[model samples]
Target: MKAFDIAIVGAGIFGLSVAKAAHDRGMRVALIEKDTVANGASKGLLGALMPHIPSQWNDKKQFQFDALRTLSEEIAALEEATGVSTGYRRVGRLMPLYTQDKLDHALHRQDESQTRWRTAETGFSFNVVKETPFKDWPAANTAPLGYIWDTLAARANPRLVSAALKAYLEPRITLLEHTKFDRFDEDAGLVHLGDGSTLMAENLVLSAGYEGFDLIKDLTNQSIGSGVKGQSLALKLELPVELPVIYDEGIYVIAHENGTVAVGSTSERDWSHKETEEPTLQAMLDKAIQFCPVLEGAPIIDRWAGIRPKCRKRDPLVGLIPGHKRLWVATGGFKISYGIAHRIAQALMNQIDATSGTQIHLPETFTCAYHFA
Candidate 1:
């Protein structure tokens, strides 16, 4: 029976972040993965770190804003410690405004961002402009009214970030790859593995993406989350790495530093196959090429499909499992997992250590108490 200070079941971004945070605090952490790390949605192509519109802000929105703002520093630290680049660049984002109503809403948010989108160290803008920074990036015809160049939005290569995290963690933590979690023995503080082995830990963290909900349901008899399928396509086309991510509707076109452009994705609640590319991706590709003529004939280098964990409340489910002293959860990040993962780790670690008064505040809506209710 191996022992650890903490045991995390899942090697997705959320679980990896938790394991890294726990290890950095000088704790023996064991990370158990059913498959490989970043095998699910975390490995997806689109790494758009766009924040919510600055109007009608609440604790949830503020939490996301803080995560987006502080991610750059977090990525820098990860890169420095591992000597690997995460392909992170704050290249901003572009939203083509085609309707007068939409442009009016953007203008209102632009004014609201002056106060809502500001931190003590820096501020980001959400300005509406008639011209794009690049020609035909988003053909002027797409934005008959104008475009919103949101300075806060950024992009990261998801694969590179995962690789950097793996590099930083592989040497420090116990990684149980290709191992499935059977169950957690709360009374014994033991995590039962599918191989009939058990690892002892003072605490157990479940960050297994959508499959995590099944574990919780088995324990508490409630379904709090389900998997939402998303598909993305990577193009061989090369564009300037600093180009702002062009986003319209559900389509995201982001140019990475590796000289590849990523376009995606479809949010389907009912997916027939988890990893099969369907016609929805083609439709999105067509629309993306329409928005950016430069992508019209760009050959797709890869097509990816994965399931994103979406909570019933539509926010991340974090914090300690109610009625269980040794169990914790950190999943249901869905689309914004990459942007908010580090902060989620901070909040969960703070809870585990009973260390409060930190700048990171987990929203009430993200709690298991809230989700269980």
Candidate 2:
């Protein structure tokens, strides 16, 4: 039996980030993944780090604002230390305004939450185009409306980011891939594997996404989350468009460094992993081409599907398991996993340290036990 100070299940961005944080603190860490690292939702992510305005987020806005701000610097540091270009670009986001009312509302929100909300003219630049130059563009219907440009929002390569984290933590952490957790012996603090092997750890952290809830339900008797399937595709474009990330007419188009544009996504609640409907793909394609008519001639390169762990509250659940002394969870991030993973991992480490009588403080919302039925 291999013993470790901490055992993390799931090698997605969340799990890898947590492992990296623990390893940085000189804690012996073991990360187990049922599949390859970043093979789950993290791999399928479009890697957009666009933060919602605090005014639009209502109560939970502050946390997101702070997390995004923190991640911007954290990712830069990670990129510097790891020497891996995660394709992080602060190119800003272009959100087109459809109607006068919508523009008024956006301006009002920006004015009301000027301290929290960033808009064009205030560090960011946006313009209202009378006509979109590209053919088959959707901006025709919503033409003459200006766009809200946010300078703080950025984008990154999800696969590169996940790979960089894994590489940086490799020397200090034990990564066990293609292994599934069968169950755990609560009394002994041991996790039994599918191969009839058991590993001991002083603390266990479940960042296993949707598959986590059922695995530990017998011990915790709690349903922490569910999965939301998202389908996205990549297209190879002929012309290189220097557009930042464009969110025109409810569709997202991000230009990648490889001269390929990635467009997504459909948020379907009831969908299976093996399911890939043409309509869904077409819908995304239509929206993408509508947003950028240059994509009309772009060759379709790749398409994929991924499941995002959508919690009951649509927020990440990170804390100690109820009625369990040595178990904790960091799951149900939905789409914010890529952007918020690092900060969430830091917070989880803080919880583990606080449990071990170490003084580390985290926000209450991040470390609270979420109620799931």
Candidate 3:
């Protein structure tokens, strides 16, 4: 048997983020994956890092905003170390305001964003712009009330970023691909593998996404969360150098750098099979073409569907699992997982950073214990 400081299951962004944190903090880390990295929900094409509206400023919102602020640097650092790119860009977002009431609400959010998303060194802005200002996005005409141009929203290729992190950490940390984690002995810090081999660590984190939900159920015998299946489509379209992500109605028309626009996704709560792409995805594509006329004749290049974990409280589930001595969980980010995975991992690291004394001030409402409270 071999030993390390910590063992992480699930090579998705959440697990990789925690491994990176522990490794950076000079701890021995072992990351085990049941499948290939980023093959789950994180492998999709839509990497929208949209921020919460500044009006509803809370710890969860602030944490995401702060994480998005520094997310590019983290990806860049990993890219530098691994000689790979995450296709990350802060191209911002364009949310159309059709109804007069919605326009008024956006204008109010514009005021709140100035104070909520800004700092001295750098800041983000949300402005109500004329349709002419959007020289690149094609959906401006669909918005009867102009658009809300947010400079903070960004996008990154989830697969690229996850792979980059895995590559960088593969050398620094012990990574086991195709290694399934069975039930664990949290008190003893031991993780059992499917091949009948055992590994020991000082700590263990469950970041296995939806599968982690099942693991927790086995341990606590309580229903803590459920899976939400989502479907996305990638469209081959010709566009200019870059443009902001288009958020019109409930559809997202995202344009990447390589002239490929990705339009996603359907959040199906009551889904039976997550692997199949149903006819509803085509409806989304049709609606997207209507919303963005420029993509009228775009052809479908790829289709993706996966299940995301949603905690009972609906926010991210982080920190130690309630009543467990050494078992920690960092799953259930839902749609915001990519945008806030780094901060979630850091928060978990803070819980284990015994020598730091000063821990990251996570909002009390986001802690795992809060669900029971």
Top model by lDDT, which number?
1
Q: What is the lDDT for 291 in model 1?
A: 88
Q: What residue runs in model 1 are displaced by over 4 Å at the alpha carbon? A: 119-121, 356-359
* Ten contiguous residues with the weakest lDDT in model 2: 120-129
Instruction: Single out the weakest 10-residue window by summed lDDT for candidate 3.
Output: 132-141
Per-residue accuracy of model 2 over 108-209 as CA lDDT, tens digit each: 665655555454334532333444434333345544576665666778888989988977887778898999877666679798887888899989898887
Q: Which ranges in model 2 have alpha carbons more than 4 Å from their true place?
A: 56-59, 117-142, 238-242, 355-368
Model 2, global lDDT: 0.74
Every candidate's CA RMSD: 1.3, 3.4, 1.6
Taking all chains together, the TM-score of candidate 1 against the true structure is 0.97
Q: Sort the predicted structures by TM-score, highest score first.
A: 1, 3, 2
Those runs of model 3 whose alpha carbons end farther than 4 Å from true positions after fitting are 119-121
How does candidate 1 score on lDDT?
0.90
The better candidate by TM-score, 1 or 2, is: 1
lDDT values, one for every candidate: 0.90, 0.74, 0.84
**TM-score (all chains, Cα) for each model:** 0.97, 0.89, 0.96
Write down the RMSD of candidate 2 (Cα, Å): 3.4
